[model samples]
Target chain A: DAGVTQSPTHLIKTRGQHVTLRCSPISGHKSVSWYQQVLGQGPQFIFQYYEKEERGRGNFPDRFSARQFPNYSSELNVNALLLGDSALYLCASSAYGGSGNTIYFGEGSWLTVV
Target chain B: QKEVEQDPGPLSVPEGAIVSLNCTYSNSAFQYFMWYRQYSRKGPELLMYTYSSGNKEDGRFTAQVDKSSKYISLFIRDSQPSDSATYLCAQRLVGNEKLTFGTGTRLTIIP
Candidate 1:
């Protein structure tokens, strides 16, 4: 089965600019979550969407926002990018059942803000 | 303190050696624990997952959890150069569907 897919694989943005990363969950999976991983660090939660509703959010700022489409695809948008925003953004998806514990992740989109 | 704590090691070991990784957590409510392996520039791939307090073994990997001390471990036997990557420990309350992760340890199994 095709796993979670994310795009574009790499991106570059200037300070004060904006960027958008996208993800498509696995077939039959309805829940999608976003995470940010800095170099040499683990993935930190960003936002989660299930059934087109925001289910959870992380400690990120208002500059970050996300939405889930009807096809279970997701988009992560970050505004006013800072140098600290350089990182790999991950997308994960799982079924919305007790089996939500088994989440599958995508390769992630690497964003560099200068 | 963070819910999960792991040493950010660039640990080097020889091929065929046994390797041990550990994480300590502060949340007693965390009932499920997991170990993930990540190659350079890639997302984490789940390696082992266990719930509550017990042990689970698969192939060259063994995962142990002790909820009393809030400690968990992942043991890799007969390590290979293919195992050279970063390992992250994560924990979450069962049914909560959110995971808290550690800083990750980089392991290099020299050939």
Candidate 2:
């Protein structure tokens, strides 16, 4: 089966610009989550949407937002990007929205801000 | 202090040797633990997942969790060159979907 997939495998932006990253979950998955991974660091959770509803959010600022569609795909939006926002944005999916379910991740969208 | 701590080792090991990776966390609320392996520029692939404490083994990989000490470990037996990559530890609390992750440990299996 196809794993979680992300779009815009790589992107380059400048300070004060906005960027949007997309993700499509595994066919049978119902929950989608977003994470930010800085170079050499682990992925930090950003947002999770289960059945198109916001389920959880991480420590990211208000500039980072996400939404899941009816088809279980998700999009992460960042406004007024900063150099610190340069990182790999990962998307994960699970068959269920619970903690017990296994989460699968995508290759991620690499974003660079100058 | 960071919630999770892991040594970002550029650890080198010979093929067929035992490889062990570990992480420590400060949060007691985290009840679900998982280990993921990632190749360069790729997404993490789940290698092990466990809840509560104790140990679970899958094929050549073993996962050990010590909730009392807030420590978790992943051990690979008869490691092969294909196992060379970054290993990451992740945790989530019951009823929560957000995961907290430790900085990955890079391993190199010398053939």
Name the best candidate (by TM-score): 1
Q: What tens digits encode model 2's per-residue C-alpha lDDT throughout B23-94?
A: 999999899999999999999999999999999999999999999999999999999999999999999888
Displacement of residue A112 (Cα, Å) in model 1 is: 0.1
lDDT of 1 by residue, B1-111 (tens): 677889999899999999999999998999889999999998889999898899999999999999999999999999999999999999877666577899999999999
- Model 2, position A37, has a per-residue lDDT of 96
| lDDT score, candidate 1, position B4 | 80
Model 2 residue B88 lDDT score? 96
Which ranges of candidate 1 are over 4 A from the true structure?
Answer: none
**lDDT, model 2:** 0.94
The worst-scoring run of ten residues by lDDT in candidate 2 chain A lies at A94-103
Backbone clash pairs for candidate 2 read: none
Give the per-residue lDDT of model 1 (tens digit) for A1-114.
889999999999999999999999999999999999999888999999999999899999999999999999999999999999999999999897884258888999999998
Candidate 1 chain B weakest ten by summed lDDT: B91-100
